[model samples]
Target: MGDKLTTKTYWESYYSHNHADKKHIKTVCGYYNDFWKTFIDSKNESSTIIEIGGFPGRYLAYLSSKFKLLPTCLDYNSDTSQIEASFRIMNVETYSVLQKDFTKYKTPQTYNYVLSNGFVEHFEDYNHILDLHVDYLAPKGRMLIMIPNMRGYIRFYKYLVDYQNLKIHNLKCMKLKVFKDFAQRHDLKVIHLGYFGGFPLGVHQKSNLFQKLIYKGHRLVFKYVANRLLLKKPSRFFSSSIITILEKQ
Candidate 1:
């Protein structure tokens, strides 16, 4: 599928209707913040950070507020006319937000930190965007990537879930071994890789208090037991929402 048509159908639909879960949103923001603090060593205040696929400006704004650095966000959703005015606000003074397809846009500037949360997998060609970002990065620059795990527990339960009927799941997920090989081939160092979000498979069923309690217990056990023993692979957790930080050599 063409980039324009595929992006609109997948991103706009999710941003408009599916991304309303407060807990999921919180986990995402926290993940990025921790990554920044761990990797940047308080030096992010002076660096240029670019966030790809930042929707509605919430997480970008949150990161901007935390690091005190302006984040340039590139997104495919150009129809800002449909988004709420409150969702359009950004805090960075030096940063610019462009609503364009990254695959087609060329730039002369390099960034200190190139970050994309749940974006690279969406494109038909993963290496294409990865090469672009690596080329766009300054020497010693780092990149933070987050994508859904294809082998994660939640992905197995998709048939039992109704709201996740979207076809973008391919873009949303990747096998870890394949990803590691790709990163190595591209000269991107995988400095860290691990699970972040709790298994998303059972989150939907936790609508009621009783279900929520049971789900919470299940999550705890899965994290320490099922994931460590039964599944043995960390990717089996929560449909394997994997977060990885890569640095260009």
Candidate 2:
């Protein structure tokens, strides 16, 4: 909590410089796709949704595309007007609230789906962060938390390109067991939880012949061998993220 990584100022700079208008990524792994449909109908246009720590609101845009539902973006750095303007261009109906600290934000409102992507792993008091998500969730609502696979083998690539960000994340929060235990501690129901999103070889690192061969070889195995045999199940060694879908109990 004392570290610069845990500070709101750090994240404000991060969003301002990097993802100010980052495009919403559409192509997700098959497992996530199935889980999406299993948890929510594609035609869903009425369920209330919220994305915490979503600044510049890219995931909000993505969710609008995925579920055809309007989602609220709750972030300290968010500009409701800017986000809504962008969504308007994209024909998405959305709203945003700018709040510096989610833990202290007062709200009687709860959402049907509460979500955060790459959010919890930055804090040492990650459990407390998770508690807030649970608190904002409506009864029977599901909260989806996704943390990057920086603790796994992919960390090497992340370190090579973005070591500052690598240090920004608390690696301890990336473990699958942490979320599983957290759900149990809170008496929440684990809808679906595990390491997900197939191998991430798309990290564009400067490669020599050796690295190129290694990456290409793994990409081949990931697409043809691993995905086929494992049914595209994500493993810690190759997965890009650890995702948990937990229902408030």
Candidate 3:
């Protein structure tokens, strides 16, 4: 990984140029919102949440729609006008957006939940990054971390389909034991650890017709056959992402 400043510049430029489209945001927000709602349903409506690396605030907007929350979004990207506009479009009020690096940012108050998705893997010093997230959690608060599971079947499919630009992912893999060790080091209890989402056949988007057909066929199998057969056992080998829920001790 690059130096802190170099990493910051990369993300700033990335976000500045690659804002998610409304449709994509809606889809991702819906997926993540389901997980949040399921985990937090019993909590008070006034629960506070801080989403580190929440660039477009789509997840924040979704949570706001379901519950009265105190949301704070932190990201290195300085220009968040588009994200603010998205919040307005979603009718989400009472949220704060901060332009700061999570590894160094300090908060006066800890939160009920600290959330991150596709964030920690960017850094070489992921242990430090994990510690930073835990520092912002109140006692017994939950930290939700989601990252691409490179060991999963999606990687194998990409290789088989000869997916273009496979080298783009900064981090190689997020192993299950890595997360368990991180939680143990911080004295945080691992409440939930599992893989979700189906195979990522979408990575072959730029490939040939045969590759595209394979992608679609695999998607259907996951949707119809694999899902029914494997609903009780979401394999780390096949799932696209790994989700880890930890509670502060």
Candidate 4:
């Protein structure tokens, strides 16, 4: 009924307000860890990664540790002092934070990996965003786009728990076909595209006692039973997130 919450002001306000909260930072790091573990490997140890729209830099810190890459973070936020502080607190040895709008800004240097998580969905011109991300890739470089999947069990559970939960999502859902078509149009090769995170085990500081209990139960089940049963067939319709991995042509 009301307009979607997709403005830059909204996010700037949200991040500025919650940037200092340890629980929120932990949750973001945990989410990125789970999503990236499915793709990152030892082969990327020497690759250069640039994260567009990365603010408050937790995910960039994770990538630096996991892949041994000095990642560059580009965001449009007016102030990046807090993000810099976070990098220091995490003991991230090498990283660059630039204050620029990736949607329009051009860079002279390209990277081996262009990555964004939960970023593109906020913009209506998602096609343009994808093109910009592709433009930042070097030859044979990889691009990873991750967003929430609306058709997943997490959405169902959120709605069951609180019907208004969907309103917080600016865009409804990112369809898999949309990413495929975008890649095909740009002549990029799709290396990986699938749903992931079937269990709700990430950190959520605002969750009520019941929600926390549910997350804990899911973690136990995923570690003991679900991991073994779903080792070979991990793709599920009820996964919480959708990941698309692309390589330049």
Candidate 5:
């Protein structure tokens, strides 16, 4: 999140009503998908992972409990109750929270895995954001960065719907070429880099009558057509997300 655009309260307020409850939050977070499994597994149970800007810790809770990996969360949000509650519900015991600005926060310790879901696209500076993530990442450890694919055909739908919501996101970070450049510049190896998932139009939003009708048709069509398509061969035109996996020298 950008300091100039989004304040700490913005996140707290956003997440306050973002979900119905701690348990139900996982549903909105989506499944950890087949694409993620290629990089999600750990070499050891003690291998640590940290989620930057991971408020609520949905992914952290699931990864920690399922893989028995130690987890940490870094965010500007001061409240950790929901994150703690998520861990408790998942029966995760080894987890911690780093409550502060991720861009500004300094840490002597590094983690085995560093990930950020739907993050890094909020700020204006991708170079600074990527550098910060690398700063706290351990050598040979994988850093996974995922962001919504707004540059695709969905851009038009979002423009017709929530244009303001689109403004906060740095859609350029969703580009594969951008991350490839970063990896080369930093001497980090790209493990996996590509688009993922077919386009999903079912999730609703406030829109005009015409936009609503158009999106409704999309909802019906994508429900069947897009669902059956191969996820590994995601195209930049309408893929739901961009995933990049990098390892340091």
Candidate 6:
């Protein structure tokens, strides 16, 4: 736990307050839908699935209807009131809700597919849990992970505006190289990896229309300058977020 705030309390409060914040939550759901479509691509909807760190289970509810089955949702904080409420609201069946810490929980079975959104970033020992997941992954099964990009231009701007700092190091940023190396170490194959929000209108949500339009334009302009002018070199430091897909090697 970090000294300034307890992680469990932080997450509990976040989900409790933000789960029903319609616009923001729906925008997040849209991102999940888009990313899942990219990976599944017309596959049968009744695929066996599991989601680690399934906060509030809103995505799980959406996915259950779309995929034709309720997914098994696992979380470290099952005691959170929001978590319990989510389970009731989502009407999730066939779940193994555990309150155990993620670092201590071992993977139970080789799943056909495992999905996590904004999960790996919070943990200090992320790789260990990742390795466990890979070990329990069925052959050819896929693991999808999404993370905020630490080196993104907007984050750079945030550093200057919010903290008056020229640079900031986001511990959550898992560079592609580092991810690839981790995969290789675990005998997992890197199937697909890329940025999510570096194009016009790519943001999931914004506070207002003006902010939306401006940020959308900012994303496009930066992407153009990063890709065309810099020969995509700036991409290493300019993507707003990252999505990684991996298969067992």
Instruction: Write down the lDDT of every candidate, Cα atoms only.
Output: 0.61, 0.70, 0.73, 0.70, 0.77, 0.60
**What TM-score does model 2 achieve against the real structure?**
0.77
Tens-digit per-residue lDDT, 201-228, candidate 6: 2433223665556665665776656445
**TM-scores of the models, in the order given:** 0.73, 0.77, 0.81, 0.73, 0.90, 0.70
lDDT tens digits, residue span 95-182, model 1: 5677877888876688887777767766666756666777667778877777766454454444434224424446433666655775
**Alpha-carbon runs more than 4 Å astray in model 1:** 1-5, 17-28, 80-91, 163-166, 171-173, 202-239
Q: Looking at candidate 6, what is the lDDT of residue 5? A: 17
The TM-score measured for candidate 4 stands at 0.73
The top-ranked prediction according to lDDT is 5
lDDT of 4 by residue, 106-145 (tens): 8989998888888876665666666778778888887889
Q: Write the per-residue lDDT of candidate 3 for residues 1-249, one digit (tens) a residue.
A: 243423566655556653435666677777665567655644588788888898877776666556777788888787788668667766677788888867667878899888898887766677777778877899988888988766656667777674442444534447888888888888988888878776555562366788878778897898777865554566778777788888888
Candidate 5: list runs displaced more than 4 Å: 1-5, 18-30, 202-205, 230-232
Model 5: ten consecutive residues of lowest lDDT: 17-26
Q: What is the lDDT of residue 10 in candidate 6?
A: 61
Pick by TM-score: which candidate is best? 5
For model 2, residues 36-127, the per-residue Cα lDDT tens digits are 66565566477888888876666666666568765777877533555555456456755555555676786678888887888888777887
Off by over 4 Å in 3: 1-27, 32-34, 41-43, 160-166, 170-173, 208-217, 227-232
Tell me how far the alpha carbon of residue 6 in candidate 3 is from the true structure, in angstroms, after superposition.
9.1
Compare candidates 1 and 4 on lDDT and give the better one. Answer: 4
The residue-by-residue lDDT of candidate 5 on 1-249, one tens digit each, is 444346678778777743324456456544555544666665577789999988878888777776788899988788888888888887888788888787778887999888889778887887678877888788888888888888868788777766767777787677888899888878998989888777746433467798788877877777677755736467888788888888888
How much does each candidate deviate from the true structure in C-alpha RMSD? Answer: 5.3, 4.0, 3.4, 4.9, 2.5, 5.9
- Which consecutive 10 residues in model 1 have the weakest lDDT in total? 82-91
Pairs that collide in candidate 4 are none
